[model samples]
Target: MRDAKTLFDRLGGKDSIEAVVTEFYHRMLADESVAHHFEDTDIAAQRAHQTQFLSAVAGGPVEYSGSDMETAHKGMGITDAEFDATADHLDAALREFDVPKKERTDVLAAVASYREDIVEADSTDN
Candidate 1:
């Protein structure tokens, strides 16, 4: 009988996730559209928190100890464009590690679900 592998296992576990987070942040820092968000932030601590969050999203054994998405991003004025840019960077980082398309899609989909919480609706949209 074959056992099912969790996304975490398929994603190469904590080490791979950590590497991906590091790469993701590097890409984010290079993206001018969203880079300003981290200008005053601690990259090391942010990476650690993101690593934990992604691990939990991937079904890893670790639980995320960070703030809730809405609470964490509240009042940041995160627009849709900025949110998309961040997602794009994450996609690029996963591709950098040669993560398979299916896995990449799955990971992106999981994070995309939080868009409502992370993105503030533009007042002009109304």
Candidate 2:
């Protein structure tokens, strides 16, 4: 009999997820478009939260204890362009680790579900 592996296992479990999260943040920090969003953020703490969140999203045993997407991003004024930049960084991270195309698509799709909560309309000073 074959054991059914979850996406988390297929994605290489906690250690791999942690590595991807670290790489993801590194990419984000280097990106001029989205780097400012994290200027005042505690990156270590954010990485921990992201690791847990991604694990849960990938069907791991970890439960994410962080704030909800909307509350966590409240008042950030994250525009669609900024959100796209962030997604691009994540995609790059996954690719850097040689994650398979289908798995990458799955992860991106899961994260994309929260776009409405994470992205806010661009505010203008008119």
Every candidate's lDDT? 0.92, 0.91
Count the clashes in each prediction: 0, 0
Worst 10 residues of 1 by lDDT: 117-126
| Per-residue C-alpha lDDT of model 2 across residues 2-87, encoded as one tens digit per residue | 39888899899999999999999999999887889899999999999999999999999998888899999998888888888888
**In model 1, what are the clashing residue pairs, if there are any?**
none
Worst 10 residues of 2 by lDDT: 117-126
Tell me how candidate 2 scores on lDDT.
Answer: 0.91
Model 1 reaches what TM-score against the true structure?
Answer: 0.94
Tell me, by lDDT, which candidate is best: 1
